[model samples]
Target: MRPNIVVIQADQMAAQALGAYGDPAARTPHIDALAADAAVYDRAYCNTPLCAPSRASMMTGRMPSDIGCYDNGDDFAASTPTFAHHLRAAGYHTALVGRMHFIGPDQHHGFEQRLTTDVYPADMDMVPDWRRELDDRLQWYHDADAVYTAGASQATVQQDFDDEVSFRTLRHLNDRVRANQAAGERIPFLMVTSFIHPHDPYEPPQEHWDRFEDVHIPDPAHPEVPDPAQDPHSHRLRAMSGFDQRETTDEEVRRARRSYYAAVSYIDDQIGRIRERLETLGLAEDTVIIVTSDHGDMLGEKGLWFKMSPYEESSRVPMIIRGPEHLVPQGRYENPVSLLDLMPTLLELAGTDPEVASTGSPEEEIAPARRGLSLLESARRERSGRSGPEDRDVTIEYLAEGTLRPQLTLVRGQYKLVVCPGDPDQLFDLVADPSELRSVADAPEHAEVTASMRAQLEAQYDLRGLEAEILTSQARRRLVAEALQRGTVRHWDHEPDPEQRYVRGDFWGALQHGQIRIPQGGAEGAA
Candidate 1:
């Protein structure tokens, strides 16, 4: 019998916010305890720093760029092979409880069932013309009122939503176990409990906020460098209207950091509740629990607030897997791994073929052209104190929001190179400057290192068949214009509306009552 799987994924969670990962202010006791029984991957990264693409990559085990899911609004091709589909075909009951961000008609593409649906903004599918005409743009929360009041210092915005998601998940788990027991069938279920907290609106419950009030939040290891010669991308962020000139005050930064930590603690408490329930139901030993995040947040670091950068603060995430002692014991692997490895890894653990199937229509080609080895094999090798043949240098690439060119790529054994698309390159020696505070691309003394890293980056681009030519200034501007017109463009400066103010929650209810036009197209209307 294959072990049941429960993947608990959090949105926009940074590794530095976890106590196990060395956050002095963190209080993730449940996750820390799970870490004691599981193997923790210390250097896991997301294929894309943003939500939709990163989640898409994890579902497909392919790079976001490869699938044309380069930005937030781009929908995953429904026909693409997904890990859940593979497991479902292998006779496992797979279900997604929250926040899949499928963005299209075929939301439940792989899973046998979905417990919740359409948690993202409905306007994501609005027609291009309608999107262009709208003054609010793609901002969902702009029309809604703030969830937290001006005088309220607590992180109440996110707590209510997080609690609801957790409640739904626990109910599903308990019901599943009860049904399986009554039928005398072994429960081979794969349930993904995804939470949308810590992503934005960085608010937690009052209790959680109070817990971190006295904790000291440290500044980023490398503060903002005012050198124009450093990296053009950093300068680009600094040049944006609200983002460029904005510097977070120490009090505001501390408040934001405290809210973030409080969110983590809140999630941790929910995980504890679920774990206790699992133990009470006797599913603790047999079920494998994997906890991770889609990506990390900047949290007022480097004068920047959100993800979409190649910096470690945005790219690196936390991954902790617990269960099946014979398969994986308590340990920590520092080997750099990408969240793209999760699909194949989970399939392997479920005793199913990790390989994608080749049989499907043109619209349903449910297999990957290129696939990597499963991380489970690496875990086994690590447990035995041996190296796996699958162990090789990993490369991570990032493309700026509107630009089609690669903004950054890091080769594991070598150095990291940041490309400005049409500008000069920036190189950082990982050994010397892990924080990437200095650029050595122009330093004559490190000519050999620079050449080596540049060559490696070029080879990676060549292998991937990415366009090597950079976009012209006019072309870049046009691309941004097109993105703005398409409603795909997103600006982080606009604060998210408070959770209580989501009009969609009530608007969706109204749709059922025939209060609004049952438009020609799906949820967001014609487009």
Candidate 2:
């Protein structure tokens, strides 16, 4: 029997904010506990540092560039197959329970069922205009509101949506267990129980807020903020988000940090509940669990509060995997990995050959076109107390709402290279200077290292070509958005199963029987 797969995806969660990732200020006990038993990737990242692009990359096991998912409004082209497509072809019951941020009409890539609609606008709302005036902030840009009014709230739209996500997912698990028992069969399932939290609005439950008031939250590494000339991309992002226009106090920053911490804790608690339910059903050992985030938030790092930047805080994310002990390994793997690796890894765990059925291909055309390597064998080696694989270069990209150009990154063991078309190249020796205080690109001593990294970046991406393509795509999307908003709009948001059936309401009080027609099994409503 194949192991059941459960992926707990959190939104806008940074590695630096997690207790498992060495932030003492965090109260993520459930995440830490999962980290203890799993093989953790210390230097994991998102292929593209945004919600829709990263998720589309994750589902397809291909880079965002390969699929042309450069921004949130970009469609996950219909022909594009996802992980669910591969798993379902192999007879697994696949389902999505929460936010995947899929744009366009075909919401379910291959999942047989979707429990709820996406929380954010699923249309062209995320598209950016390349022609907009410089320094002109969008109406929806991240502002000082979250930081100034940061505090505990009993409930938020985010909390309410996630509550339904959890309740429905747990209910699905229970129903599946009972059905399988009745049929005396072992039907495998793949469930993605995703959550949207720790993202923004910097509000969590009051209980979680009180849990972190006394705890010390460290100031950002570059708390003084960088000069516009020194770090052009950071400066551009700050301006784009309207952060440069307002002055936020230290107290506000602290409160914002506290609220973010509490939000993470809230996510931890939800994950714990899901895990416990699986264990209660005796499905824990039979399931392979993977936890990750779409992308990381800056959270005021370098005076930036959101993603869409190449900085570590905005790009690096957490990737933790746990499964049957005998079937898998444990301990941290230092070799760099990203969400791109998840699709192949999931296929491998389900007793399928990743090389055979690449996530984006149909079963008959089982060719290996994956850009990421599976870590199953290496993770097993680590569990048996053997040395892991050598450090390798991991690539990250950013081309979204923030700036006029694209930012591509290449991260090796200790070196991080940022390749932006307009700005000067940046090279950081993370071992010597973790905060990236100064660039070593101009240093004579590390000239060879810089050359090699730049060559690697050039080989991996055509920066000039991508920039042109991104600009063209943006213009077309903007025109389409304008035309669609003229009169009646056709939205792509998923409409979940409706509530409040008419027959169930006040039938006894009215004493009037209104004849209602029923839809037949194979046809429309019968009169």
Candidate 3:
């Protein structure tokens, strides 16, 4: 019989924020305990930093750009292959308890069922008739309320909203066990329990926040950020809504960090509850429990509030796997890995046939163009002392509006290069400067290193068949218009009123028709 799979994923969680990862202030005893039995991957990274794209990539085991899910509002194509589909084909009972962020028609994918949760549908960007009646000012206020109210501080809100997601998941597990007993057959389950805490408005329950309030928080090593003139991305960040140019004092930074830690702890507690239930049901030993996150939060690193950059803080995440002792050894893996590798690894563990794995391929016999290898195989090869195949260097590309091209890519070895279309390139030696405080791109002594990394990046772009041209204003208008027409709009602040708000499609039409012109070039494209 195959082992059951349980994936407990947190949103916007950074590995370093956990005590297991060496943060003295973190209250992640549950995850820490689980890590004791699991193989802890120390260098796992998200393919993209934003939620939609990152989730899409992990679901399909494909890069965001490769699949065209380049930003938060972009929808995953319905025909895209996903792990859930493959697992269903292999005869496992599949289900998602929360937070798939599918943004398309096939919300369930191949999952036999969705227990129940608030899923931001694919049409969320479009303006509904009820919302269209409201005026713009009223709509903006409504949106603000919706977001601020949903931010991470209130215990009532957290338990009422996210905790239910956990409860439903646990109930599903219990039902499965009961059904198996009744049928006199052993069955495996693939369940994903996703939570939306630790991601935003920086709020945590009062008690959790108090636990870390006294803990000392370290200010960024280089608080003196680069001049905005030189770093346009930094400048644009300051200009964004909710981001102010005022100096971030040590006290405020510490306070924010404390809240973030509290949020993580809260999520950790929920995970602990789920694990306890699993063990009580006698399925712990036979189950493969994978804990990870879609991406990492910056927490004010580099004067940035959220993800989208190629910095370590924004790109790196945590991946822990615990199950049958023989499958995953307990230790940390220093080698780099990508979340895109999870699908193939899961398929391998589930004993999925090669034909099921090839479902999404144009030629069923040919394997998909996967850039990742199975983590289980990699671990096995390493344990045998045989020199495994050379690790493929990973790369990330960001193509936000106003940028000349999707020009940021990080080669896994030790060098990172940031290309700004129509501007000088920035290069950093991550081995020496992990914080990326200095750019050695122009240093005469490091010319050879810079040249080598640039060549690798260019070669990767060529191999991927990427077009490096910046989007023309007209083109941008057309794409935005298309998104608006196809997407639904939900106000975060006020009640839904169609008369007061512009529908996504109508908004896009206005922009395309020259009614609105968004400012570009400065910090507009910063992550």
Candidate 4:
């Protein structure tokens, strides 16, 4: 039988910060130990860097464009079939215990249970307006003050929420274990224990903050950000994020860096507790554990603060999979895989195929997931002491708050391409310049490679049509958001169904078996 699945997902954590990833500043002993026993993917990235789109992609096993999730406000259509639905169809109980950053009202998204509501507002309030200029910034944009104001916090809003997430997850596990024991059954579970720590506001708990007190935190490789006028995309992000308004001293950067590292360690501590609880219940041996982040923090790298840009710091995420010793392979894989692949990957682990599941959906809407290969199969091949088939092409999309238009990234092996409106194409050779300080698009030595990648990107995406679709989406969402935010706001926030009963019938199988037709503008679909 397939083991239970536990997803410990983090927010805004960069791959560079983990000791497992060779960061000297991180105090993540727990994560390092987990990596030692798990299979690590060195080049895994989120298809879209922003919170909602990337997370939506991971959940549904589809690209953001496939699901029409361009920004945080883009509602993840309930019509989509998620891995939870697949697992649930296979008799696994699914639950989410923390922040999923789901914007719409239908927050359960196939999870049989959700322990808490999300931290961010669950509406179109955060919708980005391309028509709005820099001075007319969105209300949700970052303040440079967050960097300057960084320090140890006795208590913070994020810490409190994550603490509750951890508690609820542990309590849920204990409940399940005892309930299963009393019932004399080892019921399967797919639990997502997510956390919002190690995200920005860069203020960690005082104790975890003190743990890194003596650690030397380095400033961003290029602390001097580019001029906004010259690099419109970078400048737009910098200005909208409010980084353009402030001049900070070295002290501010150091304080922010230290706090971020401490924040990572704080979450690492929580991971230890959750893992210990799983072991205590004798579930570790039969559970498949996954640790990853939605996206990465810039941490002042290249003068960027948060995700949204196509830079490596913002695009890449950390991923580790620790499954049953006989199943999961150890050691690192240096090929490019994406969070977009998670849906198919998890589905395969649960003993179903994405190809079959794609055909199972009522409308056959699960196409993008079929595009990604499962890492479970790949890991098994690697365990036999042979290399697995390599997929070099990774497609990344950006249509969030930062840009007036859309952006795309096509990464093939060492050369990565980034193309957006108003900025010249950027191509970086990661093997040659890992920091991505320079774009060799203009170099004659790499003309053929750049041209080839550009052709691939253009062939893959229709820029004019894609931009039109995005604009239409933005306009529609903004119009709806405007009329809805009158004297009273109808919240789309998901409240956990207090009656946590598990229905035995397959959720997806009902669709596959054609027993139920998914309703149009389903009860939960309307704003």
Candidate 5:
């Protein structure tokens, strides 16, 4: 039987913020435990740092620009064939729960069902306008308020939405198990439970907040860089988010970090609950659980508090895949991987004969230039004491808010090249200088490596041409967004089917079969 797949994602969670990824400040026991027996990717990154584009890349295994997902407000066209569609085609039931933040119509995007609505808007309201002046702040841009007002909260919109996500996720898991049991057979499932916690507002519940009350929360390694000394992209993000105009004290930074850590812990607890449910339902041995995030939150690194930057704190994400030992290897991989890889990884995991993988022309679905290798194969090679592929190059893009031109990153071997159109190219040897405090782009000794990587990056993308395309997309979306606001709105948010959820009259029989905590304890009508 094929293994059941569950991908639990946390929004804007940095690899540096998790204990599994070597963050001592993180209180994520469940995630760490999962990492202990899973394939932990030490160098996993999102193809894009922003939320919508990053997820779009993950779903389609294509670069954000390739699919026209330029920013938060861009629509993920229903025409796109996602991992869900591929898996479903391979005889798996797929569902989405919680925040996907899919903009525009067609919220499903090949998902057979959605148990909860998205936390953010599903319209083009949050689109970024590249036509505007670089310094002019948009209505939906990030600000320093999330940092200055960070703390524990009794109740918040994020908390409420995440709570609903957890509830519906558990219910869906149970429903699947019960349905399979009733049919006297197994059906593979691909469910994505995405949470919006730890993203912003920097407010976690008091219970999780108190866990770090006495613990030491360190400050940013690199303090605020003067405007003249900051990198072009970082400087753009700072000015775009009002980071230059604001004054966040040390205490505020600590509170924000503490709250962010608390939110991570909260997400960790949710993971624990999902695992426990799987075990109780006798699905643990046949289920593959993937823990990761769309992108990383900078927190207070270099005085940047959010994503939309190419720094490690904002781009690197934790990716852990846990399943039976026979199916998954137990080891950490230093090879760089990105969200774009998940599509092929998931398709390979769906079964021995997934339609997309067996087609012999996967490029028909996933373009060759944007295609990613299967990490599962890489793990198998690692377990056999064989060297994995040598020519591994992971690319990341930041084409969303907080920039004048596109920021493209090329991670080849140990060196990373950050290139913008006019700004000087910035390069860092990740192995030697993990903190990326300095640049080796102009160093004569490493000139060969920098030049080669820069050539490869430039070859892969036409930055100026891409920028013009992005500008055109932004203008078109802004016009649509404005026109929609003036008329009677037809919201595209997903509304859970009442007939398919809970103990509704139409769903009573199915709900009862799944609701029975004790097997054959009593009849359905018996109190």
Candidate 6:
């Protein structure tokens, strides 16, 4: 039987904030335990640092550029074939129980069922205007308020939404187990339980907040990047988020960090709850659990408040896969991988050939060249000592709210090259300078490496062409968003059926009301 797949995702969770990823202060014992017995990816990154684009790339196994997912409001076409679609086609029951930030009309994408409506709007309302000046921050963009008001809260919209997410997800797992047992069958399932925590507003429940009461929450390693030395992108992002307009104190920073940590712990507890349910239901050993996030938050790194930058704090995310020991051997892999690889990895785990599953309607067709490397194969290569830095290279793009032109990054070997049109190229040797405080692109000795990386970047992406396409997409989306708001409006937000949300009677009446069977020698059973 195919292994049941469960993906627990946290929104805007940075790898640096996780205990499994080497943060000693994090109180995520559950996630730490899972990492202890899983394949921990040390250099995992998101294809795009923004929420919507990153998730779109994850779902489709294609770069955001390939799918025209430039910003949050960009529409994810109904024709797109996601990993859930592939698994569903392979006879797996797929469900999304939480926030995916899916924009456009088709909220389910490919999941057979969406147990709850998304927390964020499923429309083009949050679209960014690239034609506007960077200093003119969009009202929808991040601001200094989230950081200034960071603290323990009695409750928040985010907390309420995540609570419902956890509740519905656990209930779904229970129902799945019960239903399968009643039918005397073991149908495989894929459940993506995502949470909109650790993203912003920096306010978690008071209980989670108290988790870091006495703990010393360390400040950002490199907090105050001098204005003159700051990279153009970072500077622009800071300005775009209105961080430059206000002065944030050390107390605010610490409080925000503490609350963010608490939020992560809250997510960890939800993960624990799910794992506990799987164990109680006798599905632990038969399930594959993958924990990750759509993108990482800057969390005041280098004075940046949020995402939309190429910095590690905003780009790198945690990728931990825990499953049957025999199937997924415990190990740590430093090879670079991105969210794009997740689609192929899940398909391979479902016993489906990615190449074959990738074939579908012309609108759903995934170009083989655009597919990501199978992480299972990557693990095998690493275990056999056949994996090298050259085995995989990750590229990230950010054409979202912050910048005038598209910013792209190439992560190859120990070097990271950042390039943008009309701006000076910056390259950092991550091995030598992990903080990326300095650029070596102009260094005399590393000229060859710089040239090779630039050539690779050029060969892979037509930066000029991509910029044009992004501009056009931005203009069209803005026009549509404006037009849709006029007169009678039809919103694309998903309104989950209230009647079918809980236990209810079907056409047969009262579902399976009191269908109990008493065994002669055993306890009572459900008929």
Top-scoring candidate (lDDT):
6
Candidates 5 and 6 compared: the better one by lDDT is: 6
lDDT of each: 0.65, 0.81, 0.66, 0.81, 0.84, 0.85
The residue ranges of model 3 lying beyond 4 angstroms of the native Cα positions read 119-121, 124-152, 155-159, 227-230, 241-245, 353-370, 384-390, 401-404, 462-527
lDDT (0-100) at residue 141 of candidate 3?
18
lDDT by residue for model 1 (1-527), tens: 68888999998889878988878778888999989879898877776777777887788777766665555555467778888888888888898877766643467768876765445642243222211222323443111111121112343435555677788788767666655745567758889988887766665677777886577767655566436655555555444313443455556666666777777887898889888767656677788999999889876566555666677787889989898878656688766677878887888877866654212222443322123446666666666767532344445555434233566555454366666457577777767987777778889987886787666656545533444322232244345445655645553211222333224656875343322223454333211
Give the range where candidate 6 is weakest over 10 consecutive residues by summed lDDT: 518-527
What TM-score does candidate 3 reach? 0.80
Cα lDDT, model 4, residue 318: 91
TM-scores, all candidates, are 0.79, 0.90, 0.80, 0.90, 0.94, 0.94
Question: Per-residue alpha-carbon lDDT of model 2 for 1-527, expressed as tens digits?
Answer: 68999999999999989989999889999999999998888888888889999999899888787788888888888678788988998888898999999987789988988989999877877787667864776676666687788889988999899889989888878666755754568789999988998888888989889998689988666666776766788877777766778878888988888899898999999999998878766778788888999889887777888688777888899999998776557778776677878887888888777764444444443212226657665465554656443345678888787767888888877888888887888999888988887899989999999999888778777788989999999888888877988899889899887644245768863232332223456222221
Q: Hey, what RMSD does candidate 6 come out at? A: 3.0
Q: Model 3, 1-527: lDDT tens per residue?
A: 58899998888898878877787767899999999878888777887776777888887777776676665545568678788888888888898887766654556767777766444445434211211212322221112122223333545554565778877887776677665755567778899888887776677878777776567767655656556655665544344322442555566666677777888988998889888777766677788999999888777777665566677787888899998877667677766677877887788879864334433453543212235556676576566755232344566666542233465666545677776554567777778998888888899988987787677666555522343322332245346545656657443211111222234566865343332222364323111
lDDT of 6 at 64: 88
In model 1, which regions exceed 4 Å deviation?
122-157, 238-241, 357-371, 382-391, 400-404, 444-449, 462-527
| Poorest stretch of ten by lDDT in candidate 3 | 138-147
**Number of clashing residue pairs, candidate 6:** 0
lDDT of 5 at 500: 42
Q: C-alpha displacement of 104 in model 1, angstroms?
A: 1.6
Q: After TM-score superposition, what is the CA distance of residue 222 in candidate 5 from its true location, in Å?
A: 1.4
Better of 1 and 5 by lDDT: 5
Candidate 2, superposed: residue stretches over 4 Å from native: 356-370, 378-391, 498-527
Task: Evaluate residue 332 in candidate 5 and report its C-alpha lDDT on the 0 to 100 scale.
Answer: 93
* lDDT of each residue in 187-267, candidate 5, tens digit only: 889999999999998999999999997888788887666244438778777788887787789999999999999999999
- Per residue, candidate 4 scores C-alpha lDDT tens digits across 1-527 of 77788899999999988999999889999899899989899888888888888888888867788788888898888878888888888888899998988877688888988999898878987787788887677677867788999999988899899999998999888667655655567788899988998888998999998998778877798866754444578888888878777777788888998999999999999999988877665677788889999989888887878788778888899989998767677778876778876776778778777665434454654323124657665565555646532344788899888788788888887878888867888888898998877788889999998898788777767898999998888999999889988878779987766743344477764343322223364422111
